[model samples]
Every structure is written in C-alpha cells, then in structure tokens.
Target: MELTTSNPAQPHGMTWLRDDRYSWFLAGMMWVLIVLMIVPEGFDYQRLATASAPSSGGPISRMLWLLLLALGIMMVSWRAGLAWLLARVLNPFFLLFVALAIVSVAWSIDPALSIRRLIRLGTIVLACVAFVLMSWHARRYQNVVRPILTIVLLGSIIFGLVFPALAIHQQTTPELIGAWHGLANHKNGLGALACISLIFWFHAWLTREVRFLPALTGGAVAVTCLVLSRSSTSLAATLFVMAVLLVLLRSPQGLRPYMPYLVSMLVALLLIYTLAILNLIPGLGTLMAPVTALTGKDTSLTGRTEIWTILSEHISYRPFLGSGYAAYWTAGPVPGADSYAFVWRMGSFYPGSAHNGYLEIVNDLGWIGLLCLIAYIVVHIRQSLQLLEIDRHQGALFLALFFQQAITNLSETHWFSVQSVDFVIMALATTALARSLLEHRLRLVFGQPQPSTIGTSHGMALPLARESFDRTPDGGA
Candidate 1:
C-alpha cells in the first residue's frame, strides 16, 4: 500500500483518479449533488416576487441565463453530439430546434420576463450541466448508471415525500393544504413524482439493483401522497405511468399481466373524468351538488374544461408557435386560483403549466419545433425501452423516469419548473446511462460482438456526451 512520489510527467499513487471508472463515479456523484441542491430551490424559488430576481427587468434576456448553462455543459462534454448518440438515433435537427426554442423564448412577453428567465435558467441550466457531466462519465464506465440514479431517487423521497408529510402535520392552520411537494410545486407534482419514483423503485426491484421490501414502501408512500393531493389529473398520471412501466417490465405471469394495469389505469382515469363531468361518481356529485348550488357554478375543475374549450379555438389559430413560451397560460394549465380572469369568468381556476408538454411545444415553438421534439421523444423512448427490456443495470430505472415525466407532462410541467429538479436530473443522467446499457443489452440479446474499449477517440459516439461538457459557472444557476 506504499505510495511513491512521481515526476511532473507521470502521476503518483492517486493513479486510480485518472482511471475512467473513477471519472464515471465522480460524474454520478456530481449529478446527485446537483439534484439535491435543485430540488430544494424548486420549493422556495416560487415564493419570490419577480422584482427580487436577478436581471428581472430585461425584456427577454433572461433566456440567456438558461442557455448559458447549456453552453457550459456542452463545453464540459468534450465529445460533441454530431458523432453517434445523435447520429445513431436522431435526425440532428431536433437538437438544433431545441437550441432555437431556447433562443425563441427571448420574444416572450410575460411581464415577469426577467424573473421568469432567471427561474427557468436556474432550474434548466443547472440540470443540463449536471446531466452532461454525468453522461460523459457514463460514456466510459457504462455500468454505474443504476446505483447513481437510485441514490438521487432515494434522497428525493426524503424531501419530496417524507419531509412534506411532517411539515403538513406540524402546521396547525386549518387553511393549510398539505400535499406531496416532490421537486415540483403542487400535488400534481407529487402524483407525477410518485409515479416516477414508483417506476424507479419497481425498476430497481425488477433488475435487483434494490430489494423488493423498500420498493413497495417507497411506491406506497408516493401513491398515498398522490391520493391525498386530490388532483384527478395527477392521480391519473401516477397510475398510468406506473401501469405502463409495469407492462414494459412485467412477464406474462406478473401481477395483472401488465396490459390489464394499462387498460385499468386509463379506464379509471376516463371514468373519473367522466364521472366528474356527468356528476356520477358515488358521493362526488352529492358533494358537487351542494358546492355548485352554493356557488351557482360548477367549481369542480375550476372551469378548466370550459377554458380548454375556448382556448381550443386559439390553439387552432397558431397551431405552430402559438403566442410564445409560457404563453397561453394567460389562463393557467389546470384549474386553480392562479389565473384571475379565467378563474373569475368561469368561477374556477385555469390550468397552470399548460397541462401538456407536447401541445405547449407546438404552441410555443410552432409545428416545426414540435415535430422535432416529437421525434426526440419517440426515439429517446424507443431507445430507452430497448434497454429496459434487457434487464441491464439501471436500464429499467431510466425508462421509468422517462415514462413518469412524459406521462405527467400531460398535466404538469416537469421539464423546467420549480418542481423540475430531480426528474430532470433523473431523466438526463439515466438516459445517458441507458444508451450504453442498451448497447450492452443488445450485445447480450443477440450475442453480438463487443465494440472496442473506451478512449478510441476517432469517430467515437460523443455528441452530447456529458464528459465533453464542463461545469464552469457562467454567472448562472
């Protein structure tokens, strides 16, 4: 164990630090730290008024803050995306479009523009940096993906579920509405988060990265918190995402046969919505009757269904790039007290967060960008799933994270919001890990030949590789 001194040209006893495996471990560690920091920020960031944020008066310049981090990430990741990751699966234009979309946010007219910019920048840029760094390490080591992600998720549960419950119970105010606050802002976030965690937990158990005992407990807490949040949309998001994941990972003999879970979850959601509409659920209508009778309005949904009807008209006008980024929510994404006009006019709250990430893309970046985004989702999901099915290291966990985010995106914004920290890190880091896991699985599944080892830099798939980017701060989040 004795260590020898070394000359400037040669390394000393810490030679393992230079090993590719250590690099990967450090990368994973970096992402875990980033998520831990970001998740806390999400809970508190929304409390500040726009005037309190950095560069709060700029017209559309706040976007620069967000993009700066992405640039920093790209710089750190020495491997550019043009190589294999993008080339192997993507059309390349999607990456370009994401860049354009970031640029386009500058034209947004939201009065809180500067504050909005800082908030988004802090959330997304930080996430991008963490992900890129993790991805780079993963490029070489490949197998550390699962354990690293599991660490983030377990830690998230501590804040997202456990702490929120304790905080709610401690507060004596009758007006206090306690719900799951996992990385995002509301109960819907908890629902989405619960589903996401459940997927990861299940994935862990399924792949044996984690034991089953803890998985059930974690999954149960998440789902229970979602139920307490009382958000129909979020509740559905949790069940549907979980059901989909179970289907993907389950064997024919597994519980509910997977397909049944899928169908049952969807049916359950449809029934709930339908019941809400028809006033048909057992006691729901009785409760609604009194509330509607008292208010002379269908306060349920806070009138989002109605607003969606009205907004559906505008959505058609500029099917592409409608209004601008974070636009359209002049009426919120879900029913709530957030949008005064929509809430007042309809006697309920308009939706916040647009309720759908895909539609929001079409509405914000226009059809062109939306198409590219769609392609990315499709390709990414397809590639991720391929890995999940093979039962490799953290492959299923990656798919679970992606699925939870995508499914929840229908009714909540998990990509770049106060609640976005953990999921974003989980998605990006896990996905990068999944790429290699998939390749390995593919090798195993088909008994294919192994590729050359890492560091054969010539023509290596390095596009968007996390290591290619640097963690240099750009006076940003």
Candidate 2:
C-alpha cells in the first residue's frame, strides 16, 4: 500500500478551515473580548451591580466568564493540542508565581475569596494564551493590536461626549470633578489606557508602517484622553517611555551595551526619589518643592506616604506570605478597622489599593513573591533586548512597554491583578518574548536560517512557530 502524505502547510485537520477570513473573524472576537475585559464599562458592566464583588458570582459576570471559556475552547480546538501550546508558551518564573498564588489559598484569610479570585486570574491568563495562539502571525498580531486600540480610543472619545454621565466620573474629588473616565470605571483607568495607546500609536507612526494622517490622528486622540483624565502618573510614565524609546530607536546598535548603565541610573534615581520622599536626605525636600508645586501636590504625594506607612506596618504581620491574593482589602461596606483608618487618613470612605504595585505584591504574596516577580521582569527585559537585535522596531516597542509598566507600578497597583489592562499588556509583552525565544531556540537546534519574519526594518514580522512547523517535511519533530 502506498502511503499518503499530508500538506505540511496545513496541519491538525484544520486545512479545510484555514481561511484568512476565519482567522480575521477569530481575531476580531478576541479583540472585542480584550476591550471588554480591559474596559468593562465600555459594555456597561459598571451599570450592573452584579459586577461589583470579586467573590460575587453575579449573573452578568458568570455569563461573561462562560463567554471567555467558550472562546478559549474554540481557540484550543482550532489550534489542536492545548498541552503542546502551553508547553511552548509558559515561562517558568511566571508559572511559579501563579503556582504560589494557587498555594496561597491554603493560608488565605478568606479561602473562598482567594479561590474565586484565583479562578478569575486563571481565566485572564487562559484568555491571554488564546490571544497568543490566534494572533501568532506577525502581521496578524499587529492587526489585532492596532485596530482594537484605534477603535477603543476613538470610541472612548465619542462615548465620553455622547454619554458624559456613564463615561465620566462625576463623584470624584472637587479637583477632578470634570475629569473624563471615558468608558472606564475611573479617570485613572482612562489615563492609563490613553498612555499605552499613545506609546503603541507613536511606535506605529515612527516606524512609518501606517499612513501619516491616521497615525497622527490616533496619537492625538490618545493625548487628548490622557490630558482630560488628568492622571499625573500616567502622563509622567508616558513621557518617560517616549524618551527611552527615542534613545533606543536612535541608537539601536548601542542599546545592549548601554543597558547596564541605564538600569543602574534608573535604580539610583529610584533610591534618590525614595530618600527624598522619606526626607532622609538634607535639602531634598526643598529641591523637590518646585517640582511638587508644578504637579499640584505636596511632598507627601497627596497622602500616599500616609497610606504607604499604614501598609508597611501591616506588611510586617505576614512578612513572608502576606494576606492571600486580594484578601486584605475585603472587610465590609467599610474596610476592617486598620484599613478603614488608612482610608480615613486618605480622606476617602472606601479602602482602595496600595497605590504601589510593589507594595501590593508584598501585601498579597510577600517578599518571596516580589522576588519571583522581579526575576520574571528581568528575564523578559533581557529577552526583549535579544529581540531588538533581530527586530529593532518590535524590540523598542516591547522595551517601551516594559518601562511604562515599571514606572506606572511605582504609583499604581496593576502588577498581577485580574482583568487589568496593565496586566493584560504585560501578558502580551511576555507572550511576545516567549515567541522570540522559541524562534531563536528552534533556529539553533535545527540549524535552519531565520525566517523572513525576523526583521530589522519598519515592517518587521513575528517569527511565528507555526511557520517553522509548516516548513518542515513532517511538520516538525
């Protein structure tokens, strides 16, 4: 009997379904899900009381969860072999952190709350996985990101103007009464989204992949939202990322050599800033006084120091493994006595986040968890630089994102939160790093030339693993 050979380009019995239209449709659904996940208010989830609690299995939330699960199932079915996909995508440090979160349930203050939040976190990770699988192709990946952000940014502006009550937060402090939330639950959320959109669009413009007018329009929209939201941290982080990007783009060949010095300078600046905030250095407060006046804040950073003081005291109670994920901030209509007092000190009735990502991680998982997170970030940074060597445009984008997250984390707590836009962006960067590394490893192992997808040009494509598999005679070993 003669053996029949299958077409290497189409594997896993998906050849019949391998139409560009199908891929685009799947990607479109994934993009919509991302927008919904990041900005739930865009879909009016904020209007539903059921979307309030982390542990509340409300109908709307349950339905959304089912929808996400269905999407993941569809992606896995289309791709075939979830196990193999996961093996390639999973980063050890990230996986370890997730594992730690799961084990934290054993020691959680509220076991039920911890389990529920863990499930939500898992859902977010799985959704991210599905996204990576669907948009594995470079052009497809850019298509997924660019159009989604453009629509979201433009839609935010339209929604804010048309439905001010829903899109803007009216209950903010007097200083922020007219601030535009723009399809988000809070003004800062809009600001953060705008900041990242600015970075993405700016990269697209600088690379000249898109036409000048459209790129300029996208950037303008992002800047307008960012300014209207009045989020100082987001604004500052955006500017900082832009500066770093400019430097890297100008001297791509010198990036790796200067990375060590750049990292040292950043650490030094952080230390000086911390010292100045704590008044540990003489005359530092005086030096910062002018800067503070311009930013409309005091040396105390508008009571953030007080909140940090309170959190630091509580952190000592569980130094190694703090109150389980999202456990400490759950008391009642009001927070527990200590947290309530902290909020009262901040002149707010509700207990909010630590407002510092590092502190929040320490509060949730302790120093050990924080170290794991640091390692994960370092690995990603190194990997991002490696990608830059092959594809400067994509590398610069990844690095800019990394810096933006790092800087924002100094003042906001979105490191590993469920369904947070910041976390989702971080997940995306991590997925890209994984893809880059996988491509490099496969090239080394098989002694094959790098695919055309790896580039150092304006339109650099992603070196998709599927392409490598398809090129093989027997669909890869």
lDDT of 1 by residue, 120-155 (tens): 544454434334332333233223433444444454
Compute each candidate's TM-score over C-alphas.
Answer: 0.58, 0.80
Clashes of 2: 0
lDDT of 2 by residue, 305-394 (tens): 877777888888998998888767763435554456665665564536887777788888988888888887777666676677667777
Best by TM-score: 2
CA displacement after TM-score superposition, residue 124 of candidate 1 (Å): 4.0
Ten-residue segment with the worst summed lDDT in candidate 1?
Answer: 10-19
All candidates' lDDT scores? 0.44, 0.66
Candidate 1 structure, TM-score to reference: 0.58
Q: Which residue ranges in model 2 land beyond 4 Å of their true spot?
A: 1-22, 40-58, 73-90, 252-260, 267-300, 331-348, 443-477
